[model samples]
Target: MCSHIFNERNRSFSGREVIMINTDAEGIVVDRPNRFLCIVNITKPVTMESEMVHVHDPGRLEDILYPGNRVLLKRAAEGKRKTKWDLIAGDIMGEWVLVNSSWHRKISEWVIQNKIIPFLNGIDTVIPEKKFGDSRLDFLLMEKEKSIWVEVKGCTLARGSVALFPDAPTIRGRRHLEELIKARNEGHEAVVLILVFRQEAESFSANKVIDPDFALTFSKAIDAGVKVFPLCFSYEENTIHFRSLLPVFQKS
Candidate 1:
């Protein structure tokens, strides 16, 4: 009966816990001055020509943030802010992807609460930003006395049907992988959940070409009993929802 409920929720496309966004405007990317800001030409709410927007993602989005590429922005909710728009997602290679890293935690939490993943089933409690050793993991789920530390990574860069993480070199990400391995060694379950923000990706891998150090660390972490779960999601209009689980392409 519980299994049926979980499967039904996954099948619904939009999960019951989905964050609703009533208003999202389409735009064209004009320029991104830095990691935190972008200039986009709004095409909705009277097509106000050009407006500066807040980019919630800090990673270098070279593949997606090209000039003239279509983007989706949510209007700042009646709040006094420097920018009236927040860049949420953008189109790449004919597919829309959620680029806002800030939403990663919420999406992960929704997945856990809805029991969308098989391994995460039967979780009795979900704690966010749990400190383990010298690192703060994204989530610490408990089932009775057993605990599982999970680190979530948002992957927006892909080549062909393969998705990759840390489009830029990330020393911080490598350290988290090391700590997850340590947790596994100490008799607790450890997992790295890759949120592949793409539509057609069939598999995922650590970006060895961009960050070889992270790639090597990921390999070691998996060998030390750390599990990897890569799930693909699609962005349509104003909604971003999980589509299906993806296989991890092991590096040879």
Candidate 2:
């Protein structure tokens, strides 16, 4: 098992320890044809012209995917691929926010493996995408005989200093919350781990205005003993790393 421990002695040029990430190149958004593809002007390949890139995030990122917005892209591995670049992160309000949903699972897995998240430490085994009921959960952590079901969500929508999830309405997200509640009721530890891809967030809340059903379901999940953990992180250029955990408002 690979474990990462934060060292105060090691620091980067910005006075923060360099957090390793998976992105390779930088680009400026030219246009987003749809949710899956975006046209960007590459900065690393010396490409003065705009090129179409793949966007893995399914959410409607109106706030971050604006024209001229700085974006981080991962170059596709040498082979036949749909697009040469994959849009992963974006600069919003001067901070780099992770826009890719694919990283949500990996980041949460890293935290769990490193035992960085409070109350979820000492995991003996970590399993990804485990089946529980009708849905596939993000992780199933085993510690001795005790098991925990974890669902991870990437939060990119922020209003001022407050971070919110599901910028758009998501019936799927609400269903996941219901499953978490079910797992909790069956004598297993259930958790919804929210990864806020911003640094300035003071607290975490469900976007009730956008999806009232999700908000209500989230509250019900909490009432049924489902734990919700929201943690903040920041990225600059190519490095991405954890910052700290934020206060969770299940009712908000």
Candidate 3:
């Protein structure tokens, strides 16, 4: 078994640290810097003495920033882009920070290789285009030779045993469910994977009051044979581990 100990002030880790456990131990890392815009996880807010500015990186802003995200920062160093600050190394800062462009790619790569790949053998899956049908579906998997269209929803919202999806209402999410339902009718399996970042939620459900249309679409999809799987995992300082699969709670 591998373990990771955080050295917060130095912004580094101990030796042979397990960046991601359980899921894909081989692909996770610690202390590596990535360049991508990230939203601060406002669910776990951090305080800063100085004000930080948000800038646009035209290339990948859409993939990085979310409404309630907070970002990590490094003092402007010599020879770096004037608008950018170095992102912090770990996920547990006082505030949830958006990873910048460079960091975003690293996180995405880590998730795909470490988190997503190891789970593939258990199911037949395909790598769909990042952006599809006005919404990006993470992986299109086929189980029992049946196609399963999945939209990977990353969950950062957690309050003890409760886990919430899309802290803000998502129009794209509604569309994704609609698409999944259509795929189910076409004789394929359609599903959603709520990838919970923290090991807090024991069950998952759509934030219906937050977005009724999403709730309606989710109901229709499940009724039409679209499966919803909520997975929770733990990230100890730097490493990530798969906990247990949680059942999805459908809202009436």
Candidate 4:
């Protein structure tokens, strides 16, 4: 298996070693009245003062999005929609954790294209949003005549060195695992690629406390030959640095 991917750079100028996704305006979060909208005090990059920013992550980010927390925002296009900015990342425990779902595809594609993962090093082509049965997975990797179906999940909740997914209950996430099991049954290599945005996360596991059903289905999928890779990353100053591959939690 591949160990940690690090180079000769600190956490700030870090991701020049990896993918450098950009973010513009900075803000201090005020409140999240609903799931998709957050009121923030835009402090930099043409300060707009108070504004409604679109939140892309669905996870319950009480720890990061609380009042007065620093965040990164990407300004929406001129006259694009109602919301002027998008919440991209938040400062959590001294690390910038990427909470944006929009970057998941770019990060995953970069990792795949660069042949970072050992098992996926042989991938020749990557097809996005491919349909498999009734489900549309994130990517379909083609290597020779073999097919590999992948579903990507962005994880933001972590405690100490352990990372847990779906800070809130997710029936849809459970269904995704079921579809992965079905793909495995059909003799296709199925995988759930978890992007752990928490920089300190050394391992990943299902949030059984939040959604027991998802945790149960997660185990079932693993038992049914679905591979899971909980990879660690950190978002720092408009760039994302690949950290390491975390293992699944196995209870004794």
Q: Candidate 3: misplaced stretches above 4 Å?
A: 1-83, 86-125, 130-136, 142-145
Q: In model 2, how large is the Cα lDDT of residue 242?
A: 74
Q: Model 4 compared with the native: what TM-score?
A: 0.90
**Residue 62 lDDT in model 1?**
94
Q: Per-candidate RMSD vs. true structure?
A: 5.5, 6.4, 11.8, 4.7
User: In what order do the candidates fall by TM-score, top score first?
Assistant: 4, 1, 2, 3
> In candidate 1, which residue pairs get closer than 3 Å at backbone N, Cα or C atoms, i.e. clash?
none
TM for every model, in the order presented, reads: 0.89, 0.88, 0.58, 0.90
Q: After superposition, which runs of candidate 2 have C-alpha atoms over 4 Å from their true positions?
A: 1-19, 22-24, 250-252
Locate the minimum summed-lDDT window of 10 residues in model 1.
1-10
lDDT of predicted model 2:
0.79
Ranking by lDDT: 4, 1, 2, 3
Best by TM-score: 4
Give per-residue CA lDDT, model 2, range 67-100, as digits (tens): 8998888877778887887888888877788888
lDDT, candidate 4, at 93: 76
User: How do the residues 155-217 of candidate 1 rate in per-residue lDDT, one tens digit apiece?
Assistant: 999889889888999998999999999999999999888888877777788899999999999
Each model's lDDT: 0.82, 0.79, 0.49, 0.83
Worst 10 residues of 2 by lDDT: 4-13
- Tens digits of per-residue lDDT, candidate 4, 70-123, equal 998887879859898889889987778888898899888877887656778899
